[model samples]
Target chain A: MKILLLAAPCLLALAVPLYNSDSPRLFGFPFFYWALIGLVPVSALFIYAVFKMDGGK
Target chain B: MIAHLNWTATLVFVAFFALVTGLGFIAGRWRAGDLDDLAEWGLGGRRFGAWVSWFLIGGDLYTAYTVIAVPAVVYAVGAYGMFAIPYTILIYPLLYLTFPRLWAVTRAKGYITAADYVDGRYGNRWLALAVALTGILATMPYIALQLVGMEKVISALGFEGGPWASHLPLTIAFIILAIYTYQSGLRAPAMIAFVKDIMIYIFVIAAVIVVPLKLGGYGAVFDAAGAALAKKAALSGKPAGLTLLPAQIMPFITLAIGSAMALFMYPHSMTGILAANSGTAIRKNAYMLPAYSLVLGFIAIMGYMALAAGIEVKNPQDVVPQLFLKMFPSWFAGFAFAGIAIGALVPAAVMSIGAANTFTRNVWKPFVDPGIGSKEEADLAKLMSLIVKVGALIVILVMPTTFALDLQLLGGVWMIQVFPAVVFGLFTRWFSGWALLAGWAIGMVVGTGLAAGPLAWTPVHAVFGLGFSAYNGLIAFVLNVAVAGALSALLPNTAPDATRAADYEDEALA
Candidate 1:
């Protein structure tokens, strides 16, 4: 969990469409396309942090 | 270069201010007590239900700054500004999971700020005091940002006075905010949000429908913008930052997550949560706030429209106003500016009250003299609120910070450090109060250092070199959580024996 948290930043980086200038398209959508698809997973991780945190009161 | 300053619109703004001030004085009696009860006066009797909470929380979440800045970022930054759209939407659902719990527990214990909850929950005076100090410090610039928003409208409308009077308009407007908020506490801003939200919805709906039509259409606007931005990027070797992609995924997500954490912990935000009638209302509001987030998505896109229209804004802050003026008539533009101007009023008032509440409870009562009566508490709260507004005014004029339009991107990094003690204590009793304090100190130091350090080229605003940055504040926040956890392991928990952290859970659950 500890190491995972530091790498947490790396996961957030995938939020941008990961594409080289050479790549034409993914599924007929541009780079922004793939990033939007990952939105839910990224959000889930953030929510998980909240749940995992000790105090909610 | 500037929108016409229609006296008629100016009169409308004045009338709105006068009515709000009148309402402010009258509000002293709306949720009246003996004039001594701090909670009753400072927080609107902590009895706010759906309607008032709707307005207060809405005003708390959205601001005049949102009216101008989001679109301005969209105008200036392009695709990167889209981050706020997702962040705003994400914030609502995020709050849905956490806010109700905080609300239920706060109301059950009659806590006012997050600090009050921190003190009561962990039975740790220092930890609570840390929360209080963080809130007061964080709120000063937030209030200053609202003043900056008002300045955007005043400047866009060309309300310049003498040259020596560069910021007179903002000074005058904030002075009004100071008086009204001091008099009515939460009620002033709570009422003003009604007008502000209505105007925002009107401006946003009009911008979505009319601006697109006037600019030839959303598709044309985006196509032109993407091409223009691409052309600009090709001409300039450096990264255009917003328009062009450059490994933005982690920064965007960190910005969102860190912002969401800071959002719930803010003093004024916590004030809205605590004032709710029930945990359910807070949750419901949390869900509904996304509705506003949907509007923010449109606001961010407006920046693109401005870019496509070749709309040249004099000041970066004028981007939204100039965009609206180009698309709308003078009369409709009046309402638009009204929306933006009054938008500053609501949160400005709430921030002042949140700061006042902290000073009265945390600094004044405990340190100065515990014997201070409830009446004195209300009185002192009112007084300190004045000082907060004045401090904000100084920041506006003296500091390099911009007006209500000011973007303290570093604010999120510094403010989020308070999370461990405020929100973390909400769920765990195993951590000692001293541990919370240690975590807070380390977090503040590390976050401040990270903000001041150079990690990458992403300085908070490119000016501070790579040393100061926005997203890295999350780095500090994570460290804060770690220090707290590690310290908790090292030190045994020491909350008073009478106060088991779970002892209040049943009441909250009820």
Candidate 2:
């Protein structure tokens, strides 16, 4: 279970076909650009969760 | 180039340089501690809180070259340059999993360098020496790149003169840096990091907002970059644009992952993590450090803005500096140049200290003289720090910028091979010390060979004739892990393990 949670972000990021396009612009950013930038915060939250859960150990 | 020099900007840069030099001198008294002890001098008494750690690590990681290079790559290549973004983002998760445990173990044992941990875990002096040597070798070029970053800023300000006049300013800047780092040690970089971070935020925030607004909007900037790439592609008769191509997908993923794994492996990064007050401080900063990555994402787009603004330079690394000079007022451009110049100094100081510590602790003490005391070690490290800075200056002045960049690229490939011994050793010690040594040897040879390309002599190109060419570091790392696993299973445990399992697991309890 711990391994699964850690692996999720790597999987989401490496799944290039999911976010490899020029459409779906956000605030003038392309889909490809915005999606990757969006993942920065999401990955940070996942890391926070990992840290919190480990502290409970 | 001479026409581009703005006296107002040069004055602003000089003023900031003087202010930082003053801070560097006074940092000796900040957070007063025993200067004689290696820990106090090398790691700033290992007492950095989360706030200080945040800026220190941020300034150390997001360097001056990064400020210049990331945007320059984006301007040259398109989405391919955004590899730095995912690499930076994913590094936090990697650090979250690895560094707290590393910090805990190192703190428990009073270890100053990663090689010290390797020696403690494996009970093999030779293995520790390998790690120490790799850290020092890799750090030299990394420092040289920082010099390259400063040289770009200096030259972009149109300070053309004879070769001696061209290099004189950098020489004086580095001399001041070496003296303060010698006197104040880690406190110097940590204290000055506050000023560096504030200036970077100001420059990046202003550039992102003001530059895009000056040239209509973000949409127009992107369109201009796209048009420029399309024209280049048409001329070259190849597919290229503002988005990633299918063939580029694999290289992009591999480069990003390889870089993330290698980031914390550098000695300076470990110095930053170990200097923190506790395991919790390290973890907290990992969560917050991605904020700098977000800033980097904005800075990368400024390369596109450079295209829209029609800035051109013979060297791509000068694109961002040239853009600032052309787009902003004289005073503000000077402020931007000062920010970049200071950015270079912070990392150079940290890298030199990190390399110096490895040399004094892992190499000199064990190999040369086991009777060395803490005071002697600190003094030796200070001397070595000056030597490392001088070495970096020579690398930049003697070599071309592209050659220095290739050396940094190869440094990553070489440094990552130590991971199985350092990071993985923190967990189970299933692999024997001899097996780990063998793995490192194989990784270094093959990684360097492939990164050196087909010539077996050239170290410039890293891509080889795989079905598709990829980052040589990742490919070599896979081979390293495989060889170690195989050797561990086949070979007997020839050497005794020096550390117990509880030593690693107990860190969680703290």
Candidate 3:
């Protein structure tokens, strides 16, 4: 269960064909660039949640 | 043709360098411990809290070369270079899952290097020797390559002379680094890591915000970068785009996964991971270390920013330095250059210590001296660390730079072969030691042969009638696992397990 949560970011991010477009610019940045940059924090959150679930204080 | 040294910039660079030198030397006393103990000297006594581990590992992994090279790649090849982004993003969860288990086991069993753990688990000295030798082979060249990053900044600061004399500043800086590291051990880099990371954070964040604003914001920068890439593509008749070309998608993802797998396999990364105070510290760092990735994302973007700024240099590695020189004031450029040079110093220290630790614990003690005392072990590791650094320095000064770069290229492919032995053994003792050793041997030859022979040192190659190309390391790793699994099913387990199943559990959970 914890492994699934942690693998979320790796799966979603490495699927380059899905989100490789320059369209849907975020604040003057392309979707491809901004999305990957934004995923950095999201990936951290997923790992943090797994940590908390594992009885981490 | 060397440019004139800017006095203001040189002074700022010197000031920062001197400050870090003092920190490096004083670090010996910072976390007071018996320097005679190999654990203390090699792993900082495993006393680093979550935050300190974050800085130390962050500074260790995202090296000065990474700071320079990531942007250089983006500058040279457009969005293809952003493979490092996904690679960094993918690495954290992998760390979150695997490394805590490694920390727990190593703590319980007093295993200093991954090879030591392999020896303990498999009870096979030959297999452990393979792991250790592969580590040293991969890392020694890496230490030399760190100097390439420092040399870039040193020359950029306009320190010029004859060939030997021109490298004098870099040599002097490394000598100071070697001395403090010898005196202090892991703490030297760990302490200096604090300053190195802060300087990097300041400069990268400053560049991210200030560079875009200087170039009239992200929109103009991307447009200009796209235009520039398109112009280059037209001239070269090769596909380049603001986004990934269809043909590039496979290599990009494969490179990302291959690199993430290889990153922690290196002994230096293991050194930083093992130095944490507890499994929870390593776990906490999983979420925290991505902050550096965010910094790296911005750093990668600077390559595009360099294009927008019309900065031209014969070498792409100079893009970041050139960007700073053109965009920022002279003094701040100096500060940025110092940040990069010190960045190089931290990893070189850690890499040498890591390889040296592998030699002392895995090779020398087990093979050379069965009853070596802790003090002698620590002393030997210290001496070995000095030798590794001097050897790397000589490699840089005497040999052509491409030799080190080529070896480093093979280094990744070679290092990943150790993965199945170390990481696989973490979860299951089902695989036989001999099987794992055979797998490693086959993987090394195949990976190196393909990389050096047919692939021509390119990272990705077309595999087995698959139209798409994949990273050679990943391809080799798959073959490694297949061979190990097939042989494990056939061969009886010969070596008894040294660690119990519970040994892999964190203390809080256990």
Candidate 4:
């Protein structure tokens, strides 16, 4: 389950074809740009969760 | 260029440079370990806690080159360049999974380098030599490129001199770096990274927030950048825009995944990982180090902001410096340049030390002189560190910068060839040393031949004349795995394994 959580972000971010569009802008950032940038923090949160599940060891 | 020198900025840059130099020297006594010991000098005595390891590894990996080059690529090529964003984000979870085991095993065996572990794991001195040589060879150009990054700032500062005298400031900065790294070892960079990172965060954050405001908003910036890029693509008959073209999707994904996998295999990165006191420290930093990636994301967008602000430069590499110059006040520009320049020092010192540790532990002690004692080994590492820095200095000063850039391209290709031997070996001893060495040879030959000869230094190559393309390193790395796996199946496992599975278990967890 923790592995799934960690792998989710990696898979989502690498599937570039899925988010390769420029529309649906947020704060002036294209969906393509903002989605990848947003993934940085989201990926961090997931990894942090996995770390916590590992007892933070 | 000469007339552009601002006294306010130069003074601030010099002041910050001096402050870091002083910090570099003073770091020798931090945590108060014996300077004569190899572990103390090379790996910070394996004593760095979670926070220090976070800063050190972050500073070491996301270097001055990344600061300058990522935005430069984005400025030149549009959305294709932000591959660095995903590449970086991919590595932390990778770290959470793979590197703690590496740390556990290396610490258990008192190994200072990946090559050292390779030697013990495969019991093949020849194979280990290949690993060490690849590291040193790849690192030589990398260290040179760090100077190239620093030179951009130094030249931007417009210190007055003829061609010969222009290098004076860079030379002096490096001399101080070499001396302190010799005296203090990894501790110098570990301590100074705090300053480097804080300065970077301040300048980059300010740029993202303030640059967009000055040029209307993020909307205006993206719109302007998109229009400009579309115009260029039409004029030049090239595929570049705010979004990736269908043909570009494969290259972008391959580049991101290929680079993320190869990043930790570098000797300098290994130095950072091995220096941590515990596996938990490494895993903890894995989740947090994405903060650097966040900063990198901001840095990549500065390219569009530069376009929107109407900053012009002949070299795209100069875009970031020119962007800061046009948008920020003179003093703040100086602070940013200082941040960028000192950014070079931390990595240069760490790279030289990593290459030196490889030479001393894997090459010199084993092959050159087996009788060398621990004290002598540490001394040799210190001296080799200076030599490596001087070699890099010569490469940057004497040769054309393009040569260093070319070799660095080949360096990445060369570096990933060692991955199967080191990382694969970390999990199982199923592969024999000879098979891995054979794979290494093929990968090196094919990767270098494609990069230097046929592909002419482009990272992507078409496979089998298909319409598809992929990163050359990834292509070569796939070939490497197939050969190694096949040969391992054929060859008997005669190479004696020096480590048991228990050695890779986290000591605290066990």
Candidate 5:
């Protein structure tokens, strides 16, 4: 379960087919641009979840 | 040789530099610990809580070169330079999984360097020494790149003089850094990192918002950058624009993943991890550190803004600094330049301390004096820190800045080779010391040759005739793991393992 959560971000970010484009702009950022920048928060959330599950406190 | 020397910027830079120097000196007493011990001096007493660790590691990782160079590349190329984005983002997950275990084991063993952990895990002094040597070799060039970052900011501020005049400020800055780091090892960088991080956040956030609005808006900035790349592509007969080409996808993914793997392998990063107060602190910082990457994403756009502003610099690395000079008022520009200059200092201090600790603990203690006391070890580390700083200064002064930058790239290629030994060894001792050593040797030789030869220096292209070039480090890493796995199964264990599996698992509770 932990490994699956950890691997999700890497898979989504690096898969190439999912985000390699200039269309589908969000807030004027191309899909490629916004997707890469957007992943920062998403990856952080996954890491935070893993930390919480690990009893990080 | 001063082109557009703005007194306001120079004064602001000087004032902030003076303030940080004062903080550097006073850092000796901050958090007051046993100054004579390596743990106390070299690792900041190994007691950094989440907040301090956050700022320290943030300041250490998002360096002056990163701030200057990332935008520079983005401005010069296109989406390719944003490789730093995914690399920084992915690093947290990897760290989340690895650093807590590393911190637990190192803290339990009282090991100050990764090589110390290697020695304990495998009971082989030679394998440990290999890790130590790789750490020092990789770190020196990284330290040189920080000096190069300082030099670029200095030159951009119109201080390009006869070699002596231009380098004088950098020399003085490094000398002050060497002294304070000598006096108070890791504490100096940790304390000054607060001032540096604040300055960076203020200026970088300001640049992202102010620079785009000055040149109309984000749409205009992208259009301008796209037009510039299209023009260049026509002349060079290569595809270029605001988007990545189909061929670039593989290289981009491999570069990001390869670099993420290599980031924590560097000795300075490991130093930051080990300095945290607890395993929980290490884990918490992993989640928090990505905030800097968000800031970096904003900073990356400043490169696109530079294009829209049409700022011209001979060296692409100078584009962001030149962009600041063009876009902002004199006083604010000075603040930006000062931010870059101070950004260089924090990482240099941390890196020198990391390299010095690797030398003192791994090399001197084991080889020079097997029974070296804590006080003497601290003294040796202090001296080595000064030597490493001076050595980097000499390299920066004598060599072209591009050479240092290339060496910095090569440092990553060299460092990733150690991942099999250090990161892999943390999980399982399935590989013997001899196999790990052999893998490391082959990886270093082949990785250096591939990265430094055609890929870096020569006109010839294509890495390993793969038709599409990828990050040389990743290629070498795959080979390193393959050789180690094969050799581990084929060969007998030459040295009996001193550390048991329970030692690694027990770190979870540490």
Candidate 6:
């Protein structure tokens, strides 16, 4: 479960830059407007899952 | 050539600087219990989580130097500059294995600085003293080079002064940085890193997507770069001439691998690692952080693309920013320049903080007074941190740009000397402290001699007759390891396995 959780953020990081052809705009800006838009939320979720297993930083 | 003064870009750059400076000052209070200890000031209360640590460490690692210079090399050297790509990629898996272990042990041992680890692990003040001196020495000029990167960006922004105009803003920038850093401590840089990273990602991604389109296609751009460098080599009289490839393939790999090994060992990287909250966070970052390198690879290619499109980067370091000016709309270019300009600031702050820690703890406490209070250490660290910034600014004004960059080459050669006593010391207790110091001293003398000698072709020149150059640091590392290993067998001494490693080796597997 812990290892599976770790793989999740990598999946999201891979997905955002590849699939968003419709220019998935953030805050009414261009698709490229927010670089970390996808990076942050996904990494956060993976970190949260890891925390449950190990307790915390 | 400095006349491309786009006020819009200048305005955006200054506005962002103001925003970054404000964050630095307030960060002194972040996660505050009390500002009474050096650890809190120097390492952000030593409790940074995944998020802050990610930005802080990333910001420290990926500087304006790499952002602009790597691409500039790609612009000039073809596949040669791509060395940065592989080096950055390979370094992560390496750091992931080593860094987490280092972080775990260091934290467990209550080691704030790498020298602190050297001191505790070997129980040899002389060995620890050699390591600490190397940290302070290596970091001073590395910090100076940060200001040099910012100045190149500033000059490309079209700012001009008298004969001295080139470095005046850099001096002012340091003064401003020093004040806020003194007020806030390491938290200042950590907090400011949020803004800096956002700006860099926007600029780098925008360049990767937008600029290539502006120049036609990636294929066409590479063809142009090839023609340009071939033309340059024709004039220079050397085959690998026009591009940064000066010598050949062997060197391309050496510079990359040598640099990668030395990267984490640099005091700045150690400082970045020390700021993380836990070993787990550092491990998590190890894989995730390679994402920055992905941006870096694309960023490096922009240099070749810019040269192909007839954009002349005034300073090679300003090549990426200048490319944005050539390709983008005025407003967008201003935004992009802000990213490069502000990007320089984050690393400068971190480098100054790292240098300050060396001066305060390694230089001051262990030598000046054997038993200083934590509050006094913190206070002195802040004071010295300011002085370190000032010292770097002086170097900024006086150094030739080429000389400033060469310092990194020397910095690499010098810092890697400490690996035996710091990194290897943890895994084994066999290497005697005296042997380690002897190895370190020899590496510095030989490396500095080769690097500083009069060899016209070499990056760091050479000492008198011995031919050495940019990659001399790697040579020094070899000599250091061999000497240390040989001497250890000759004189067996104490300093077996570390206390932190003992406690955690079982915890990790259990």
Q: If scored against the real structure, what TM-score would every candidate get?
A: 0.85, 0.96, 0.98, 0.98, 0.96, 0.85
List model 1 lDDT by residue over B1-510, tens digit each. 224456765666666667666766677677665546778767887778767798888887788887778777656655666666546545655565567767666666667777777777777778778888888877888888887788777766667655337587677777877887877778777777877888788889988888778777765676677766676568875344333354544466567667777887778888876778766566556545556666676677677778888887666668887876677776677678878888888888888888889888987887888899878889999999899889888877876653322235556665788877766666667777888788778877776655554643232322145442347667777677788889889888866732344443434343
Q: Residues B1-510, candidate 5, lDDT per residue (tens digit)?
A: 566676788888889999999999999899999889999999999989999999999999999989888988887777888888888878988888788887877877889899999998888889899999999999998999998888888876778678798888889988988999999889999999999999999988888778778888777888788898788778888766677887877788888888898889889999988899887887888789989998999788888888888887778888888888888898888898888888999999999999999999999889889998878889989999999999999898898777877777878888888888888887888898888988888888877877657345421125666677777788877788888889999986667766655555434343
Model 5: docking quality category? medium
Q: How far out, in Å, is residue A35 in model 6?
A: 24
Q: Candidate 4 — which pairs collide?
A: none
At residue A13, candidate 4 shows an lDDT of 88
Give DockQ per model, in order: 0.10, 0.60, 0.88, 0.82, 0.67, 0.04
Instruction: Please identify which of the two predictions, 3 or 5, would achieve the higher lDDT against the true structure.
Output: 3
Find the 10 residues in a row with the least total lDDT in model 2 chain B: B455-464
Docking class of 6: incorrect
Show model 6 residue runs off by greater than 4 Å. A1-57, B1-4, B164-166, B241-247, B456-470, B495-500, B504-510
Docking class of 3: high
For model 3 chain B, the run of ten residues with the poorest summed lDDT: B452-461
Which lDDT tens digits does candidate 3 get at residues B1-510? 246887778899999999999999899998799999989999999999999999999999999999989999889889899999999998999898799999998999998999999999999999999999999999998999899999998888887888898989989999999999999999999998999999999999899889999999999999999999899899998877689999999989998998888889899999999999999999999999999999999999999999999998898988999999999999999999999999998999999999999999989998899999999999999999999999999999999887888889889988889999998888888899999999999899888877865535777778888889888888999999999989999997877889888899987755
In the range B16-78, model 4's lDDT, one tens digit per residue, is 999999999999999989989999999999999999999999899999998999998888879
lDDT of 4 at B425: 88
Best by lDDT: 3
CA lDDT of B198 in candidate 5?
94
Off by more than 4 A, model 4: B1-4, B453-455
True contacts kept of each: 0.03, 0.52, 0.84, 0.77, 0.58, 0.00
When 1 and 2 are scored with DockQ, the better candidate is: 2
Q: Which ranges in model 3 have alpha carbons more than 4 Å from their true place?
A: B1-3, B453-455
Measured by TM-score, how close is model 5 to the native structure? Answer: 0.96
lDDT of 4 by residue, A1-57 (tens): 988998899999899988998899999999999999999999999998988888874
- Candidate 2 vs candidate 5: the lDDT winner is 2
lDDT of each: 0.69, 0.86, 0.92, 0.91, 0.85, 0.70
Question: Order of all candidates by lDDT, from best down to worst?
Answer: 3, 4, 2, 5, 6, 1
Docking quality (DockQ) of candidate 2: 0.60
* Candidate 2 residue lDDT tens string, A1-57: 656666677778878879999888887778888888888878777777877877732
True-vs-predicted CA distance for residue B130, candidate 4, Å? 1.0
